[model samples]
Target: MDVAELTGTYTYRSFLNRPEPVDDFNKLRFAQLELRLTAEPDGTVSGELVFSEGEPGGDTIGMDMVGRASGASPFAFTLTGKGRPGSPVADFHYEYDGVILRHWDIGIGQLMTLAGTVLRAEDHGSGATLARAGQTASFLAVKRQA
Candidate 1:
């Protein structure tokens, strides 16, 4: 598929992979995410991601992402926190590796989906390093209509 096909807004959902005894603190973090992406002619993609709890009057966070797309199935991207210095998420960084999946949705007809694994590349809050990252999650993002 053309990289341009990925330029749009999408609703994203992710589930963290915790150990057997999952506790309240180890549950999924964000309630929802909105991804607004723009694909360039050079196969590079830049975008903004907004994360919300899906609750009335709840707070939301925004981050910036940059990555490259391939004509084949593979795509990789990294998300960097846009928070101020010393903030909880100031040093947050995540890397996502995924593939574009095309399928038919009963309600939306043909649907384009992004399915992947997310790695906690950097997490200052947890003092995570390359050898001992914080956590991993699986994510799925579906492009929204114009």
Candidate 2:
């Protein structure tokens, strides 16, 4: 699938805990975020994100990314973001591969989930499958600063 057409705003929640190196930290919660995404024909996606609830950390994150896919194959993407203020931005990438969308003989049986959550596949009138785990189910958005 071409990455250019996949562009929209999404509302989401962000949950996080301190890494193993550090302990006793609180589990941070970021919710009710208004995130927008724009994918380009050249496999690049760029956009901005804003939060409507929780904390201000998610108020906006910068995202300049890319995704690649071949016919009938699962799509893959790489995205990164930086929180507002003193928040440090991080870069992460994941691929959606070998997904199955089965219903009455696997009509559209293959799906690709990015980073263990986001699901992308052929929207043909058929049943869809999560296929594998580790696919991110949430679409995150971040804005670019001028």
lDDT of 2 at 137: 40
- The candidate that wins on TM-score is 1
- Stretches of model 2 off by over 4 angstroms after superposition: 14-30, 53-72, 85-146
Q: lDDT tens string, model 2, 1-146?
A: 55653466544444343245535323344233554667666666665544333455634453323344222344454444333443332222232222212224454542222222343232212247223323234333332222
Candidate 1 lDDT over residue span 1-146, tens digit each: 67777899899888866556656743765336887888876778888677543357854455677787776645444343343334345566777777787554565576678888777676445434333456778888889988
- Clashing pairs counted in every model: 0, 20
Q: Model 2, 121: alpha-carbon shift in Å?
A: 28
**Candidate lDDT (C-alpha), each:** 0.68, 0.39
Clashing pairs in 1: none
TM value for model 2: 0.39
Q: Give candidate 1's total backbone clashes.
A: 0
